[model samples]
Target: MGIRGKDRQIDNIEFNVNDISRSKTFYGSIFGWSFVDYGPTYIEFSDGRMTGGFTTGEPVRTGGPLVILYADDLDCTQLRLKAAGATISREVFSFPGGHRFHFIYPDGYELAVWSAS
Candidate 1:
């Protein structure tokens, strides 16, 4: 079989954060994102073709909200994400069978990702 670019979905994204190290650990714990250390400037969490990164920079807390992704395990997810660098605008304790967290992009845009399982 031949390889094609379109065959793969968006696996990773890098959003600037106030502190790279903090965010890296936070997102990793929240979503169980595996972080690959990339020197002193950056780090990535990749699940095969799917990946995301955290870098040092100020994030935006404006604009439209972010797309939330549901998870099978939310309690741990929240704890992990919080450790990374996400400020829990809303804690994940009373949201049905799932929970979520929020973060700000460098563009002042607010977005959230969650899981319900």
Candidate 2:
């Protein structure tokens, strides 16, 4: 909860979503993330390691930042994301360290998932 030991590190990430409930449900199902509501307009989520927030306080905008996630099984994660109604924006591609793919959430935020396999 405290970032005192993490100087100059990325602390929190927030997403402006159209519907808080819908965002919670989608992210919860795909990543097994847990949520805590601050109010009707905002909710915080934890993926057991990192925490972020879903907020309806601002309008949803795209093309800001790229949030990349790690997955042990890239193919399976991609399948789950697609099943959860996310659109696959980029096909799986290989890079120096691993393979990755990008997906666009309903709110138009683009995120990538990568694996070492």
- Which candidate number has the best lDDT? 2
User: Candidate 2, residues 1-117: lDDT per residue as tens digits?
Assistant: 122343224445668888999989999999899998888888889999988778887678675535667676778888988999999999999954578787999888788776666
For model 2, what is the C-alpha lDDT against the true structure? 0.76
Q: Local distance difference test, per candidate? A: 0.53, 0.76
Error of 1 at 72 (Å): 34
lDDT of 1 by residue, 1-117 (tens): 112232112223556656777876776678666777776656666755566656553353333213444444556656766686666665554543344566554444555555543
**TM-scores of the candidates in the order shown:** 0.39, 0.51
Which clashing pairs does model 2 show?
Answer: none
Error (Å) of candidate 1 at residue 56 is 1.7
